[model samples]
Structures are given as structure tokens and as C-alpha cells.
Target: MDDCIIIGAGPAGLTAAIYLTRFHLSIRLFDCGSSRAALIPCTHNHAGYPAGVAGTELLRLMLEQAEKYGATREQAEVTAIVPVAGGFDVQIGDRTAKARTVLLATGVVNNRPDMDPAEHDAALQRGLLRYCPICDGYEVTDKRVGVIGTGDHGMREAIFLRGFTPDITLIAPGAAHELDDACRAKLDEAGIVHVDGPCTPIRIAGDRIAVETPAGPLTFDSIYPALGSVIRSKLAVAAGANASQDGCLEVDEHQRTSIPGLFAAGDVVKGLDQISHAMGEAGVAATTIRNLLAEQRPIRR
Candidate 1:
């Protein structure tokens, strides 16, 4: 049986593999090869990369580093996991492997906005359109920005966007009643314009995003879709582990899930979805797993 199995190849999974391998434990990383981080053009907040680095480059370096330490990465979709005698059995296609410990770093998938001609336009992809305020909010400093969403999380994004740009508009596709009074007050205090109702349509022309609203066609330098992400924590949840309301796995500070021998880190756990945070959690989880395994050794009676 392998010492541990990491269920992703993102920043967290790769980092965990690096640490576990250093502890002289065998690790297998399974991933479907799609990473939300890879979709980002460039990330500025990752530590050590002062000038910033492309998401793809960071992932490549991480995987390469893990491989250097004898970590094995498999490109496969994990269908299910069943608890076994000493560990768990992971099913991939028609094959299965036993693992003494499991680290779920499956991460999350952000729901994309409805496809439109504006989104399909080539220029927007070049650099005009962006997401992840932590990644590109600085680029929109002092510029007109539009935020699309209406819940607490959406308001939080609006407040964050306000810090970067004075001209902030909150687009609520539903009735204004959906938002609480406290949230409304916060938006008012920030002097953010609120549009309560359906958005007509949006198109990207040159460097501007044109949106038709009840008032009229308004344009902004950028639009931030504050719609939250859908966490993929079913594998852990099905194993009798707890999760947050948003589906992020509930793990201890050591990144150990409710189920013993099962751990989680990165975006899969309830916390900031940042590369630095993921790496830190991975380190803790690797150490915890190593200690757990060491304790499991039979005593010399």
C-alpha cells in the first residue's frame, strides 16, 4: 500500500507530495489535469515571484519539483474511495490502489458566466477581462469597475473592489430585497452604485465592457463576477467527513479531516484560496500524515 495519495495536482497537492516524499513516504497524486489556477493569465500574489508568474508556469514548476523528490503523479479521474483495513482504496477506472492516508486537494471549479459574443471576442481574452481580485485588482486601480452578484460574498467583493477603484457598480440581477439592510448600508457607505434588476446584455468593444441595463447602456473598464465557486468535496463528504455550507471541507488546523487518515488542504478546505495558503496547509498535512503513520507501526512487545 502507498503511504499517501494526493487527490490533485494543484499547488496544494504538489506541495504535499514534496513534503511527504522528503519524509521518505511513497505518494501518488491523481488529477484530471484541469486546474482553475491554470486558467489565470498571471498571478501577482504568489510569494518569491516578485515580478509575478504565469499560472501555468507556477504549476509546471511545482509538478517538476515534486517529481524531483520521487513523487508519482497520475492523470486519472478518481471515481470513489472506500475505507479499508489499514487505509483506503481509491478507484480509478478499472483499477484500484490502497493508500494509508489520503490528502484531498481537489480544489474548486468557478462557474463561468453565460456565453456571449462579448466573452467570445478575442480582444477581451488578451487582457481586458479579468477575475480574482487578489490576482488582478491592482490592475484596475482608479478605474471604473463593475461587480456582478448580490449576496454577502458578492458584497464582500464589491467592498474589496472599492479599495482599488472609486467608481464601483454593484449589479444585482434580482430584486433589491434579496440583500440585507446591513449589507445595503455598507454599500451605501462605500458610495458604490447599485443596480437592482436584470442586466440587459454585455458586449466587449475594444478595451471597454458595454452593458445594457434598465437605465441605459453603461460601460466599464472591467467586470468582476463575484458569483462564488462550487467546491468539489463529495469524495470527502461521502466518507463521513464534515464540510462547510459552501462545501469546503472542514479540517483541523493540521488539515486533518473529520475522518481519520483523511486530510484536505488548499481551496478544498474553508479558507482563502491562495497559492501561499495552499502550500502552507500542504506542509502541515504532510507532517501530520507522517506522524500518524509512524504511530501506526506495531510495537515491539
Candidate 2:
């Protein structure tokens, strides 16, 4: 039985693995390899990378460092996490592994419009489709931007993006911007342009994103989708952990869920969706896990 089982291989999971291994705790890190971090082209917000680092490259380096410290990397999709007598049974398909503690870092999946697979992949590679503004909104300061979504979330994003530029456009839903009078007034006060209709046929070409609407072709230097996300916390819930409506686990101070012997960190846990924050939370969780295990280990004379 491994001392800890880490689900997901993103920054949080990798950091936890590194910490656990350094403490001589047996760890098995499992990842399905569909991390949102892998989709980012560059993240200038992270430390040490002045020019920013490709998400894939950062993940690779983290994995290499984790392995160097004796963390066993298991490239398997965790199908189920069943609580057992002592700890828990981590299942991957027909296989089973034992762990005294589990750390869930399975991050959320950003909601995206249905598009051609190749086209979406190309957009992500080109950095045209962004999910987080706090990460790179500074880079596009003073540039025209389109905030896509219909609800208050979209309006809030448009208003938030306004901090960087006043030339912001809110892409509303349906054939009209169905915002209430209060919201419309809010947008006007913020000096943000509202496009009363859904954006369609979003295409990227040569450093610009063009959207087709009833009003005509609208173009922007960049686009931010505030469509929210689907946090992957089902495994935690299935294991008796409490999660929010958005599927984010409600972790305690030690990152421990309601279920004993199970902890969480990163996007899967209720917190900011930033890499730096994720790493910090994971570090705390790893230390807590180490202390918890120490209490359970046999006392040496």
C-alpha cells in the first residue's frame, strides 16, 4: 500500500508528489493527462518564467522532478475511489491500489462551445481561446477584448476586463442582450459595449478574433470566455466528501475533506484557479498528510 495516492498530474499533484517523496512516503501519482494546464500556451503569472512557460513543458518538468524524488508515476484514469477499513482503495479499471491517504487534484474542465476538434486545438495553441483573465489580462492591456457569456458572470467578466481596457464588448445570449435594466445601466456606467445577440462563427486569423453577429462582423485583439467550468469533484463526492454546487470540494484548513484520510487541493478544491495558489494549497495539504501519517505510524523506542 502506498502512503499516498495523488489523482491528477497538474502542478498541485506534482508538488504534492515531490513533497511526499522527499519525506520518504510511498506515493503513486495517477493522471488521465487531460489537464487544463496542458492547454495553456504560456503563463507569465507563474514565477521563474519571465517570458512565461508553455503549460505542457511546465508539467513535464514537474513530473521529471517528482520522479527524481522517487514518486511513482502511474498513467491511469482513476475510475473509482472507495473507502475501505484502514484507508482507501484507489481503483483504475480492473486494477486496485491501496493508499493510507488520497489527495485529489483533478482540476476542473472549462466550459467551451462545441467546435471542430482541430479548430479548437488550434485556437488553444494560438492562445486565442483563454479561460482565465487574471493570468494574462495584463498582457492584453489597453487592447480590444470580447467577453463571451449571457448571464451575470459574463457581465462581471466584461466589467472586470475593463480594468485593463475600456474597449470591452459583452457578447450576450440569444438574439438579444436580455440583461435587466439594472444590468444594462451597470454596463453603461462601466463604458462597456454590449453586443445584443449571440456570437457565432468565431474565427481567429493573424492576431485577431472575428465574431459574426446580427450587427455584423465584430473583431477583437482577444476573447475571454466566462462560460464557467465543470469542476471534477465527482470522485471526491462519491467517496463521501462534500462539494459545492459547482462540484468543488469543500476542504478544511488542512485540505482534508469531510471524509477522513482523504484530502484535496488545486482547482478541484474550493479556491482560486491559479497555479501559484494551487501549489501553495497542495504544499499545505502534503505537510498535513505527513503529520497525519506520523501520528499513525508505530512509535519507535
Cα misplacement distance, residue 260 of candidate 2 (Å)? 0.4
Query: Best-fitting candidate, measured by lDDT?
Result: 2
| Model 2, runs deviating above 4 Å | 298-301
| Residue-level lDDT tens digits of model 1 in 76-154 | 9998878888999999989998999999999998765443754633423555556688878998899998887887877
Clash pairs for candidate 2: none
Q: Give each model's whole-structure lDDT.
A: 0.84, 0.88
Q: What TM-score, to 2 decimals, does candidate 1 have? A: 0.92
lDDT by residue (tens digit), candidate 2, 1-301: 8889999999999999999999888889999989989998999999999989999999999999999998877789999999998899999999999999999999999888544668667777776777788998897799888888766788888888889987999986457876887878889999988887667878876778788888998988888887889989999898889998878999898999999999999999888899999999999999999999989995233
True-vs-predicted CA distance for residue 54, candidate 2, Å: 0.9
Collision count for each candidate, in order = 0, 0
* Model 2 TM-score, 2 decimals: 0.96
